[model samples]
Target: MRRSVISGLSAALVLTSAGVGGALLAPAASAAPASPALTTGVADGTYVSLKPTRMLDTRGSYLGRPLNAGEVYNLKVNGRGGVPSTGVSAVVLNMTVTAPTRAGNIVVYPKGSAVPNASSLNFVAKDTRANLVTVPVSSDGWVSIRNATGQTHVIADVQGYYVGSTTTKPAGAVDYFPDDPWRALDTRTAQDGPALAANDYLIQSVSYGANTANISALAVNVTAVNPQWTGFLNAWNGDENAIPNTSNLNFASRKTTSNMVIVPVTHGVGSDGTTPVLNFGIGNASPGTVDVIVDVVGVYATGDGLRFRSVGAPKRIVDTRTSLGATTLDAATTRTVTAPSTVTNSTTVALVTNATAVSPTAATYLTLWQTGVTRSAASNLNPAAGQTVANMAMVGLSDINQFDIYNNAGRTNVIVDVAGRMDLSPNLASGAAPSLSTRTAPKALGSRVATLR
Candidate 1:
């Protein structure tokens, strides 16, 4: 007897070749269709802080001299506990560019490619700044950090990485679905409901069972506001033991700050026969209460859909500061911006860009989404008066190859830098697949086997 599996989407198991009377088994479907990606509206955890370790510093003699102005450096990010040396799709790095001899910005992306015309960490001369950056590793296994405008030293600490197949899937085998950034949790005034006291941890669930099954992780913007004292915050999987030496965001007392975070999650039943959940933990390391908020932008999962492609460097896609020679976006104004056709089209579903808000008259935020859709009750970049702030935004696209940008408060200058894009096409040019291994003996149906192959 022959067994065949079929799906409503016209997917089937077919026999390719057989020897004599023997039946042949064809290759399995590359991957299953993924769920439509969207940002979840829920509170996943309260803010907690962890101590951070320095992983790399280009300024010190260890890695040689500081990065020359307008130069790029290739950095390795693997061999950690969460981010294995192999099977890593993308890495979550807390990057800081410091000691700039002149005013400029730093652009981080996949290595060995042209630097995209974008900035990741902006700074004035001698000022130090840090941002949580999620960068896909190049096929050759490194990320590029470029210094734009002036010479500067770069520092990066490993937080985590997105993992993919241990068997046949290549690095960056995961697909991304971007949601209109939505506020999933806000402790201030109990927006999404849970509040936390000092030194407490809260578990949050995002897209566990309702929208899609088998979600391995999420990409989110975590914000901390109104803390009683200076402290840091940690975001991690609820089911795993806390990694005590890492912090996601560091904030001053009574201030509002946000950082992008990539958190791994548990799915389905474990080997112990207990159901698992996509849980996140927020630990408050401050001495007093602090409100926490999360805005989900995207998710990472294995599927027969779009996967990420690094453009080698960050590219400046839109700059509203000079749009039609207009320097500022007036309050309550909405602008339709067409993404360059080179970056998006019918096959591209989402884009990853660094959205910056600078010199606003009043506290303002920027909302980004596909053109023609109802504006989501979410924002991508929020900047305070007289301050320049940038946050990475993962935006979805429609057939129009356009997205809308709306300013929620007083006038502000906006800058959009493209880091990469996600498309439905697979990288068929990646060369030959690794050889496969076979089992010599039959195994029991319910039995478990452990082998490297």
Candidate 2:
């Protein structure tokens, strides 16, 4: 039997003065010099907040000219947010690309490389869109953003950074685990069944037994559907009272939209001690109600089996649109896609691909899973009739070094760009076993539910 990808919030606008300004702090004297090979894992999920600093703008003479089509802009990431240039691995940012003269997408990757065929944001001509992006910084502390269409303006606001070491350790001693996409919270049928009221908030606990053990953060895809009014969604640690001006994603009233977020989990736990729970506060930033769906794509823990590695740039790995010697995938059909040997190794567990569907004849969603395995109940990308839609999918690979992609609706041409991969090797040399005494695996919730109120 094929595995099914099971299908699966908003609150108020209390304007808290969370300023987006900050001075670049000098690197800590005691801090180790940054290393290109070092990949440090955050066990306690410690993230230092930096004032949302603007790093780039292509409009209004910030760059002296609007970004031209196919142009790449390099932005320095080191020394921002108190992160020194030498030791940083990844940075958390709120990136907004706007004012495009024509419809196109942007791809963000490390500097000094070819632009990956992947896309970070897709916009209509002259429309602005923002999304939370966690991108890897190159050893030189720079990242590159490529504009794929007409001239446009780009904005990046720094929030935090992750530091890692270069040594080797046991497989499961990393900071994040990229799980097969799992639906954890669905507000439509939750106790708060229905929609999140305007200016209201939803506090949801994300705990999935064993999988969430020692989890300090979660990499989730939050989707807002059937919003009653035009608004945005703000997600943060539920225990905090102040809501940052940062938004996960914006949506028009009655439209469905999704964005990726990497939020720190709360420190509370159940009696078993292993069931650590993270309080996710979802705030509705519009005047009406909206329903939210939360899906866990990965978790950051102190110990782990796989660590993330950012590629030099995103590359086109699969394009059923004829780029990779493939044909359009028909409705209700599954196609197996393989990564290049240069990209996949013995320890490779997953590949991050931006899957886009174009010219669809009907409404449908895409499901991806390891090859030879039943299709997961999770959907990776959704497309509407005669429209082009894209979403990032982190697909786990089976031993066969291939994964399956399934389209549930009309035949559509699919395009996939490989951005990065998660592998089983640790960055550092063998280290002491991570102390798991205080950590317990997540406890299963018979029916994953979210409290609506």
Candidate 3:
């Protein structure tokens, strides 16, 4: 036996095609009509909407007025409306549009005035054929409907699968919606709520530079020449070759100054040609100090300065210097202090000592539970869901004092290791990532490396 499916406007079912032959015949008088498609033509809520061929009318009128044929009519919706998206193969309408009107009926004025006429219908349809099958209607009303008959429940299925961001999601179709907030770039500037801008505590590289001098000849001068500090000043100002012929030197953390500063020193040894030191002048040059000018045309908040000394040859650190106040980090600040004498003890003890002394007196920052501290605002970097900022620190080792960094951020807490060596053990051990905040605890061996993840 074979099975075939049969559908109609009023009723449709499967009948045995098994040996039953070509087509199924209609029963008799009151049988449902045949349809070539799934949906029928009906009223459009929006400009384009799924419709049924035939409809019913519980209350029959157009805006409380009797409708007639051969008149222009329309339905209005508030927006750019499209097809009625009922995801069914067919549909049914249970409403009446108008009463039958002749070609020339009495004109019914909208403001309730009657005019002489003969047509009795509100609208007329002639060229347009009613569709009773599944059809796809373009937004512009370009429809593809063939010969169809009667009413159909499958008309709703012509909506085609559509995907959407709304609750009325249609499968396998795109949602023609507007842009969302998260989809935008950092226009207002915030990965958090509304306020948190993306910025960092930067040690402005623009304000820092090596002496603009070729620095050929140089000499140590607290007070030892025909013009002692002249050569030193010249060398710093981009003159490598000064009178004394022993002045090639590099400097860092010279002072904690906000304005132009001119410092003269015959102190620290030069690493240039011969690596010479001016061991002459005591009161003036035994210990070198860098002059400074702070806040030189840059974005700053509560300005600060720090003096760091990097050894060129991994030499033992005998002295250190700075220009910031005891608690200040200005370029003019000075620090001529002793450091570890052992090669193995590479930690610089300069900034570490200062930090230690200032620990109790320095202000502490308040950072806790700080994601969107306020409503609709951004806050400090809070770890993403299921993530944490673990093992983060900054270690400024041999790059600062002694021959190495002394301390930096701990595995648990945030700290700065002013003098610690980043290279150590020379074995199989993973290291921290590079970041500004990953300073070693002041007195550990590590570089200013940071860790992410």
Candidate 4:
């Protein structure tokens, strides 16, 4: 069995003869599209990081808060088949920008195809209660993403996905962070007023390979106001508002946590803790955009109130509407793992599904996916297919519950053994994990329960 499309986190493979083919990375536009007209030569402080935590308004709108992990709430938007993370996926990047600085949404596919097994999510939010989620159709749909506590959440919304291929170099290896500042391509590029002017846009896409090279280290795209223009930029310093780069970002497909770095800034007396106040830094960068590479978890989706999931072995991989099946692994939605010549300590887990793989369904092959999960009803609809009939660690019971592992016997390699518990319905793409109530009637797996994989 060939590896499916790839994600960032790496895993160990125990091939049980699973056959799969996935994404083909395509080159990204060297420059930002005219519609968005990415600001070029933007100042260093011009860009802002997407907030991991957000405070919701009294009416359930996101208001930017320090959302610790346990305090998050997941509310499903689309409610397709099943949610990925217990019908409650957290929004990674949370930020509110001034008017006109709209959030962006992207429907990524493998090299060459405009349309694939894709899910659309947006970043633009109108307060925290209502957000415009990008779906396949251009007709903007609104969804809820947070609660009164200002905590981000996704619940019961399900959607499937397709993935593209990633090459170690050139094609699909670059990773981007939404929370970091938007920087000029290079310091030299920063000098061009046309490219780095206030509100001047510069759109960029780096293809981190889809495999082990899936981008782990990313440059936090931060934009600083030219010390000359610092005054013009800081005018909105009251709420920490910034020129947010709502660039679409995907989670680390594999095993890793990304660290974020920030430059020293002068917190404006007029600024809330939200916006970045211009400060002196290396090179005395007096307010122009300065780009620095930083570690990141992934991007947050703004469309239909998006959802995302993190999967890895040793660390369990959850299957939701967005989960890739072993069959119909598409180029943009799949992540693949390769067997090491000499098995080392690393063990990996690839997704394999049964319900979505059958015919009459768009999904024909199992795949490896990386984009944020979907949180919409149109995405997940089927009850049986969406339910987690068998959890990941199912050793042997039903063909549908079996995991096709790669066996490199004689080689001291780590093999992933997943428990085959009953998921109300499993789909990884939505990555909206299943909730207890969502799986009210668990499937009868005949007594034995699967365990740690």
- C-alpha TM-scores of all predictions: 0.69, 0.75, 0.14, 0.21
Off by over 4 Å in 2: 1-71, 92-94, 131-134, 157-174, 209-213, 269-276, 323-326, 427-453
How high is the CA lDDT of each candidate model?
Answer: 0.57, 0.61, 0.17, 0.20
Candidate with top TM-score is 2
Q: Which whole-number lDDT from 0 to 100 does residue 416 have in model 4? A: 25
Sort every candidate by lDDT, greatest first. Answer: 2, 1, 4, 3
Worst 10 residues of 4 by lDDT: 435-444
- Of the pair 2 and 3, which is ahead by lDDT? 2
Tens digits of per-residue lDDT, candidate 4, 16-46, equal 1001111112222211111221223211101
| Model 4 alpha-carbon miss at residue 223, Å | 5.4
lDDT of 1 by residue, 221-339 (tens): 88777778777677766543544455666666776667777666544443344434355667777777678888766555443334554544567777766673124688999877777
Q: Write the per-residue lDDT of candidate 2 for residues 258-311, one digit (tens) a residue.
A: 766676656566646655566666777788888887777766555333455665
Query: Which prediction has the highest lDDT against the true structure?
Result: 2
Residue 337 of model 3, lDDT score: 27
Which parts of model 4 are misplaced by more than 4 Å? 1-92, 95-184, 187-195, 204-345, 348-453
